[model samples]
Target: MELAISIIVGFMILGAIYAIHARDILSAVIAGGIVGYSLVICFLLLKAPDLAIVQIVVETITLIIMVAVVLDSSRVEAYGKFDRPAWVTAGTAVLILAILFWFLKEASAPLAPFGENSMRMADAYVNGAVEKTGSINLVTGVVFDFRGYDTLGEATVLVTAVLGVLTILRIKGKR
Candidate 1:
Protein backbone atom coordinates (compact mmCIF):
# COMPACT_ATOMS: atom_id res chain seq x y z
CA MET A 1 0.00 0.00 0.00
CA GLU A 2 2.84 2.35 0.79
CA LEU A 3 4.36 1.55 -2.56
CA ALA A 4 1.10 2.31 -4.32
CA ILE A 5 0.73 5.63 -2.54
CA SER A 6 4.32 6.57 -3.28
CA ILE A 7 3.75 5.86 -6.97
CA ILE A 8 0.61 7.92 -7.06
CA VAL A 9 2.30 10.79 -5.25
CA GLY A 10 5.15 10.53 -7.72
CA PHE A 11 2.68 10.90 -10.54
CA MET A 12 1.12 13.86 -8.77
CA ILE A 13 4.49 15.49 -8.46
CA LEU A 14 5.12 14.99 -12.16
CA GLY A 15 1.73 16.40 -12.96
CA ALA A 16 2.39 19.47 -10.85
CA ILE A 17 5.69 20.01 -12.57
CA TYR A 18 4.06 19.72 -15.97
CA ALA A 19 1.30 22.07 -14.97
CA ILE A 20 3.79 24.66 -13.86
CA HIS A 21 5.73 24.49 -17.12
CA ALA A 22 2.94 23.68 -19.57
CA ARG A 23 2.98 26.08 -22.54
CA ASP A 24 -0.75 26.06 -23.21
CA ILE A 25 -3.57 26.70 -20.73
CA LEU A 26 -5.52 23.60 -21.66
CA SER A 27 -2.60 21.22 -21.08
CA ALA A 28 -1.91 22.91 -17.78
CA VAL A 29 -5.53 22.48 -16.67
CA ILE A 30 -5.41 18.80 -17.60
CA ALA A 31 -2.19 18.36 -15.68
CA GLY A 32 -3.68 20.12 -12.67
CA GLY A 33 -6.65 17.75 -12.82
CA ILE A 34 -4.20 14.85 -12.73
CA VAL A 35 -2.85 16.14 -9.43
CA GLY A 36 -6.33 16.59 -7.94
CA TYR A 37 -7.57 13.15 -8.99
CA SER A 38 -4.35 11.61 -7.73
CA LEU A 39 -5.21 13.13 -4.36
CA VAL A 40 -8.59 11.40 -4.47
CA ILE A 41 -6.82 8.07 -4.96
CA CYS A 42 -4.55 8.82 -2.01
CA PHE A 43 -7.55 9.64 0.20
CA LEU A 44 -9.23 6.37 -0.78
CA LEU A 45 -6.12 4.36 -0.04
CA LEU A 46 -5.87 6.04 3.36
CA LYS A 47 -9.35 4.67 4.21
CA ALA A 48 -11.02 8.06 4.14
CA PRO A 49 -13.85 7.50 1.70
CA ASP A 50 -15.64 10.61 2.88
CA LEU A 51 -12.66 12.78 2.05
CA ALA A 52 -12.15 10.91 -1.20
CA ILE A 53 -15.72 11.58 -2.31
CA VAL A 54 -15.44 15.26 -1.46
CA GLN A 55 -12.11 15.59 -3.18
CA ILE A 56 -13.33 13.82 -6.31
CA VAL A 57 -16.42 15.98 -6.63
CA VAL A 58 -14.56 19.22 -5.95
CA GLU A 59 -11.77 18.26 -8.31
CA THR A 60 -14.21 17.36 -11.04
CA ILE A 61 -16.01 20.65 -10.74
CA THR A 62 -12.78 22.62 -10.73
CA LEU A 63 -11.46 20.75 -13.76
CA ILE A 64 -14.68 21.44 -15.64
CA ILE A 65 -14.53 25.16 -14.88
CA MET A 66 -10.86 25.42 -15.80
CA VAL A 67 -11.37 23.61 -19.09
CA ALA A 68 -14.40 25.68 -19.95
CA VAL A 69 -12.54 28.91 -19.29
CA VAL A 70 -9.55 27.75 -21.32
CA LEU A 71 -11.71 26.69 -24.25
CA ASP A 72 -13.85 29.77 -24.13
CA SER A 73 -11.02 32.26 -24.37
CA SER A 74 -7.58 31.58 -25.72
CA ARG A 75 -5.51 28.91 -27.45
CA VAL A 76 -2.33 30.88 -26.94
CA GLU A 77 0.48 29.69 -24.64
CA ALA A 78 -0.10 30.88 -21.07
CA TYR A 79 3.40 32.16 -20.34
CA GLY A 80 4.65 35.70 -20.77
CA LYS A 81 8.45 36.02 -20.46
CA PHE A 82 8.64 33.34 -17.67
CA ASP A 83 10.72 35.50 -15.36
CA ARG A 84 13.01 34.38 -12.50
CA PRO A 85 10.59 35.57 -9.80
CA ALA A 86 7.80 33.47 -11.27
CA TRP A 87 10.03 30.40 -11.11
CA VAL A 88 10.94 31.17 -7.52
CA THR A 89 7.30 31.65 -6.54
CA ALA A 90 6.18 28.47 -8.24
CA GLY A 91 9.02 26.53 -6.64
CA THR A 92 8.15 27.86 -3.19
CA ALA A 93 4.50 26.95 -3.59
CA VAL A 94 5.35 23.42 -4.73
CA LEU A 95 7.74 23.01 -1.84
CA ILE A 96 5.05 24.11 0.59
CA LEU A 97 2.52 21.73 -0.88
CA ALA A 98 5.01 18.84 -0.73
CA ILE A 99 5.83 19.56 2.91
CA LEU A 100 2.14 19.68 3.82
CA PHE A 101 1.51 16.37 2.06
CA TRP A 102 4.41 14.84 3.96
CA PHE A 103 2.97 16.01 7.25
CA LEU A 104 -0.43 14.58 6.34
CA LYS A 105 1.10 11.19 5.54
CA GLU A 106 3.09 11.14 8.78
CA ALA A 107 0.05 12.10 10.81
CA SER A 108 -2.09 9.37 9.29
CA ALA A 109 0.59 6.70 9.66
CA PRO A 110 -0.61 5.58 13.09
CA LEU A 111 -4.12 5.06 11.85
CA ALA A 112 -5.30 1.71 10.51
CA PRO A 113 -3.71 0.33 7.34
CA PHE A 114 -5.04 1.11 3.89
CA GLY A 115 -8.77 0.43 3.45
CA GLU A 116 -9.10 -0.32 7.17
CA ASN A 117 -10.62 1.81 9.93
CA SER A 118 -9.65 1.83 13.60
CA MET A 119 -12.72 3.64 14.88
CA ARG A 120 -15.38 1.70 16.81
CA MET A 121 -17.97 4.29 15.78
CA ALA A 122 -17.57 3.21 12.17
CA ASP A 123 -18.74 -0.30 12.88
CA ALA A 124 -21.77 0.93 14.83
CA TYR A 125 -22.69 3.24 12.00
CA VAL A 126 -22.39 0.53 9.38
CA ASN A 127 -24.26 -2.13 11.33
CA GLY A 128 -27.25 -0.27 12.79
CA ALA A 129 -27.45 3.02 10.96
CA VAL A 130 -29.76 1.68 8.29
CA GLU A 131 -32.17 0.23 10.81
CA LYS A 132 -32.26 3.44 12.80
CA THR A 133 -32.49 5.77 9.83
CA GLY A 134 -34.81 3.51 7.80
CA SER A 135 -32.69 3.94 4.70
CA ILE A 136 -31.97 1.04 2.38
CA ASN A 137 -28.33 1.99 1.79
CA LEU A 138 -25.89 2.44 4.65
CA VAL A 139 -24.27 5.39 2.89
CA THR A 140 -27.61 7.05 2.27
CA GLY A 141 -28.59 6.58 5.88
CA VAL A 142 -25.37 8.04 7.20
CA VAL A 143 -25.24 10.98 4.81
CA PHE A 144 -28.92 11.92 4.80
CA ASP A 145 -29.91 11.11 8.40
CA PHE A 146 -26.87 11.06 10.63
CA ARG A 147 -24.97 13.80 8.84
CA GLY A 148 -27.94 15.57 7.36
CA TYR A 149 -27.04 19.23 7.81
CA ASP A 150 -23.43 18.70 6.90
CA THR A 151 -24.41 16.83 3.77
CA LEU A 152 -26.91 19.52 2.86
CA GLY A 153 -24.25 22.22 3.13
CA GLU A 154 -21.81 20.28 0.95
CA ALA A 155 -24.52 19.64 -1.66
CA THR A 156 -25.46 23.31 -1.64
CA VAL A 157 -21.88 24.37 -2.21
CA LEU A 158 -21.48 21.97 -5.11
CA VAL A 159 -24.71 23.13 -6.70
CA THR A 160 -23.74 26.77 -6.35
CA ALA A 161 -20.34 26.19 -7.89
CA VAL A 162 -21.79 24.35 -10.86
CA LEU A 163 -24.42 27.03 -11.37
CA GLY A 164 -21.76 29.73 -11.28
CA VAL A 165 -19.75 27.88 -13.90
CA LEU A 166 -22.83 27.47 -16.08
CA THR A 167 -23.66 31.16 -15.79
CA ILE A 168 -20.15 32.11 -16.84
CA LEU A 169 -20.23 29.77 -19.80
CA ARG A 170 -23.66 30.99 -20.86
CA ILE A 171 -22.56 34.60 -20.71
CA LYS A 172 -19.43 33.84 -22.72
CA GLY A 173 -21.54 32.07 -25.34
CA LYS A 174 -23.61 35.22 -25.93
CA ARG A 175 -20.56 37.14 -27.11
Candidate 2:
Protein backbone atom coordinates (compact mmCIF):
# COMPACT_ATOMS: atom_id res chain seq x y z
CA MET A 1 0.00 0.00 0.00
CA GLU A 2 2.78 2.45 0.86
CA LEU A 3 4.61 1.63 -2.34
CA ALA A 4 1.41 2.12 -4.34
CA ILE A 5 0.85 5.50 -2.70
CA SER A 6 4.43 6.55 -3.45
CA ILE A 7 4.05 5.56 -7.11
CA ILE A 8 0.76 7.45 -7.39
CA VAL A 9 2.37 10.48 -5.80
CA GLY A 10 5.24 10.27 -8.26
CA PHE A 11 2.80 10.07 -11.17
CA MET A 12 0.94 13.09 -9.83
CA ILE A 13 4.16 15.08 -9.58
CA LEU A 14 5.27 14.09 -13.10
CA GLY A 15 1.85 14.93 -14.48
CA ALA A 16 2.01 18.35 -12.84
CA ILE A 17 5.45 18.91 -14.36
CA TYR A 18 4.17 17.88 -17.77
CA ALA A 19 1.23 20.24 -17.39
CA ILE A 20 3.50 23.16 -16.59
CA HIS A 21 6.00 22.41 -19.37
CA ALA A 22 3.37 21.71 -22.05
CA ARG A 23 3.49 24.32 -24.80
CA ASP A 24 -0.08 24.06 -26.07
CA ILE A 25 -3.02 24.94 -23.83
CA LEU A 26 -4.89 21.76 -24.76
CA SER A 27 -1.88 19.60 -23.93
CA ALA A 28 -1.53 21.31 -20.58
CA VAL A 29 -5.22 20.72 -19.90
CA ILE A 30 -4.79 17.06 -20.78
CA ALA A 31 -1.85 16.85 -18.42
CA GLY A 32 -4.04 18.34 -15.68
CA GLY A 33 -6.61 15.63 -16.36
CA ILE A 34 -3.92 13.01 -16.04
CA VAL A 35 -2.90 14.53 -12.72
CA GLY A 36 -6.47 14.36 -11.50
CA TYR A 37 -6.78 10.74 -12.57
CA SER A 38 -3.59 9.92 -10.74
CA LEU A 39 -4.93 11.66 -7.65
CA VAL A 40 -8.07 9.54 -7.84
CA ILE A 41 -5.94 6.44 -7.87
CA CYS A 42 -4.07 7.71 -4.83
CA PHE A 43 -7.34 8.39 -3.04
CA LEU A 44 -8.57 4.86 -3.77
CA LEU A 45 -5.35 3.34 -2.53
CA LEU A 46 -5.74 5.40 0.64
CA LYS A 47 -9.18 3.82 1.23
CA ALA A 48 -11.18 6.84 0.17
CA PRO A 49 -13.45 5.38 -2.46
CA ASP A 50 -16.02 8.16 -2.15
CA LEU A 51 -13.42 10.89 -2.60
CA ALA A 52 -11.95 9.02 -5.58
CA ILE A 53 -15.36 8.92 -7.27
CA VAL A 54 -16.03 12.57 -6.58
CA GLN A 55 -12.57 13.61 -7.80
CA ILE A 56 -12.95 11.63 -11.02
CA VAL A 57 -16.33 13.24 -11.77
CA VAL A 58 -15.12 16.74 -10.95
CA GLU A 59 -11.92 16.25 -12.95
CA THR A 60 -13.92 15.18 -16.02
CA ILE A 61 -16.06 18.31 -15.77
CA THR A 62 -13.00 20.54 -15.31
CA LEU A 63 -11.22 18.94 -18.28
CA ILE A 64 -14.25 19.48 -20.52
CA ILE A 65 -14.47 23.13 -19.48
CA MET A 66 -10.78 23.68 -20.14
CA VAL A 67 -11.09 22.09 -23.57
CA ALA A 68 -14.07 24.29 -24.41
CA VAL A 69 -12.16 27.42 -23.35
CA VAL A 70 -9.12 26.47 -25.43
CA LEU A 71 -11.30 25.81 -28.45
CA ASP A 72 -12.99 29.17 -28.01
CA SER A 73 -9.67 31.01 -27.85
CA SER A 74 -8.01 29.11 -30.74
CA ARG A 75 -4.87 31.30 -30.72
CA VAL A 76 -2.38 28.55 -30.02
CA GLU A 77 1.34 29.43 -30.18
CA ALA A 78 4.47 27.37 -29.60
CA TYR A 79 7.66 28.81 -28.12
CA GLY A 80 11.22 27.69 -28.72
CA LYS A 81 13.57 26.93 -25.84
CA PHE A 82 14.56 29.70 -23.38
CA ASP A 83 11.42 31.85 -23.74
CA ARG A 84 12.21 33.14 -20.21
CA PRO A 85 15.30 30.97 -19.62
CA ALA A 86 15.01 27.26 -18.80
CA TRP A 87 16.85 27.63 -15.48
CA VAL A 88 14.25 30.10 -14.18
CA THR A 89 11.34 27.82 -14.99
CA ALA A 90 13.11 24.82 -13.55
CA GLY A 91 14.01 26.65 -10.33
CA THR A 92 10.49 28.00 -9.87
CA ALA A 93 8.98 24.56 -10.47
CA VAL A 94 11.33 22.94 -7.97
CA LEU A 95 10.61 25.60 -5.37
CA ILE A 96 6.85 25.22 -5.73
CA LEU A 97 7.03 21.44 -5.60
CA ALA A 98 9.26 21.50 -2.53
CA ILE A 99 6.85 23.79 -0.71
CA LEU A 100 3.88 21.63 -1.63
CA PHE A 101 5.66 18.41 -0.66
CA TRP A 102 6.58 19.87 2.71
CA PHE A 103 3.00 20.93 3.38
CA LEU A 104 1.58 17.55 2.38
CA LYS A 105 4.08 15.67 4.51
CA GLU A 106 3.34 17.86 7.49
CA ALA A 107 -0.44 17.62 7.14
CA SER A 108 -0.73 13.84 6.84
CA ALA A 109 -0.51 13.11 10.56
CA PRO A 110 -3.06 10.61 11.91
CA LEU A 111 -6.37 12.22 12.87
CA ALA A 112 -9.44 10.98 14.65
CA PRO A 113 -12.55 10.06 12.65
CA PHE A 114 -15.55 12.39 12.72
CA GLY A 115 -18.17 9.67 13.00
CA GLU A 116 -18.01 9.55 16.79
CA ASN A 117 -18.52 13.28 17.14
CA SER A 118 -21.32 13.27 14.59
CA MET A 119 -23.17 10.48 16.32
CA ARG A 120 -22.87 12.10 19.75
CA MET A 121 -23.96 15.46 18.46
CA ALA A 122 -26.88 13.97 16.64
CA ASP A 123 -28.03 12.15 19.75
CA ALA A 124 -27.82 15.32 21.83
CA TYR A 125 -29.74 17.42 19.31
CA VAL A 126 -32.45 14.83 18.81
CA ASN A 127 -33.14 14.21 22.47
CA GLY A 128 -32.76 17.80 23.60
CA ALA A 129 -34.74 19.65 20.95
CA VAL A 130 -36.89 17.02 19.33
CA GLU A 131 -40.21 18.60 20.36
CA LYS A 132 -39.02 22.20 20.16
CA THR A 133 -37.83 22.08 16.57
CA GLY A 134 -40.28 19.39 15.42
CA SER A 135 -37.47 17.86 13.36
CA ILE A 136 -37.13 14.11 12.94
CA ASN A 137 -34.11 13.65 10.73
CA LEU A 138 -31.06 13.84 12.97
CA VAL A 139 -28.74 15.20 10.32
CA THR A 140 -31.18 17.81 9.06
CA GLY A 141 -32.18 18.64 12.58
CA VAL A 142 -28.60 19.34 13.61
CA VAL A 143 -27.89 21.45 10.53
CA PHE A 144 -31.18 23.38 10.38
CA ASP A 145 -31.43 23.91 14.12
CA PHE A 146 -27.94 24.11 15.57
CA ARG A 147 -26.07 25.42 12.55
CA GLY A 148 -28.96 26.91 10.63
CA TYR A 149 -27.78 30.51 10.85
CA ASP A 150 -24.21 29.61 9.90
CA THR A 151 -25.41 27.66 6.89
CA LEU A 152 -27.55 30.61 5.79
CA GLY A 153 -24.54 32.92 6.10
CA GLU A 154 -22.39 30.52 4.10
CA ALA A 155 -25.05 30.31 1.36
CA THR A 156 -25.25 34.09 1.24
CA VAL A 157 -21.48 34.33 0.89
CA LEU A 158 -21.53 31.74 -1.89
CA VAL A 159 -24.26 33.60 -3.74
CA THR A 160 -22.32 36.85 -3.42
CA ALA A 161 -19.20 35.22 -4.84
CA VAL A 162 -21.14 33.85 -7.80
CA LEU A 163 -22.71 37.22 -8.47
CA GLY A 164 -19.32 38.92 -8.24
CA VAL A 165 -17.77 36.48 -10.70
CA LEU A 166 -20.66 36.92 -13.12
CA THR A 167 -20.48 40.69 -12.88
CA ILE A 168 -16.75 40.75 -13.50
CA LEU A 169 -17.02 38.40 -16.50
CA ARG A 170 -20.18 39.92 -17.93
CA ILE A 171 -20.06 41.63 -21.32
CA LYS A 172 -21.40 45.14 -20.77
CA GLY A 173 -22.44 46.51 -24.15
CA LYS A 174 -20.91 44.10 -26.66
CA ARG A 175 -17.78 42.14 -27.40
Best by lDDT: 1
| Model 1 alpha-carbon drift over 4 Å, by segment | 36-65, 77-116, 159-175
- Kindly report which residue pairs in candidate 2 clash with one another: none
The lDDT values for all models are: 0.87, 0.80
Alpha-carbon shift of residue 90 in model 1 (angstroms): 11
lDDT of 1: 0.87
Root-mean-square deviation of every model: 5.6, 6.0
lDDT per residue for candidate 1 within 1-175, as digits (tens), equals 8899999999999999999888887898999999999999998988778789899999999888789888999967745665577879899999999999999999988898755658888888888666699887777788888889999999999999999979986784633
As for model 2, its CA RMSD to the true structure in angstroms is 6.0
Give per-residue CA lDDT, model 2, range 1-175, as digits (tens). 7777788889889989998887787898898888899988888877767678889999999888889989889636677677688889999999999999998877854544432343455566667676867776555666677889988998999999999989888858764
Candidate 2's TM-score reads 0.58
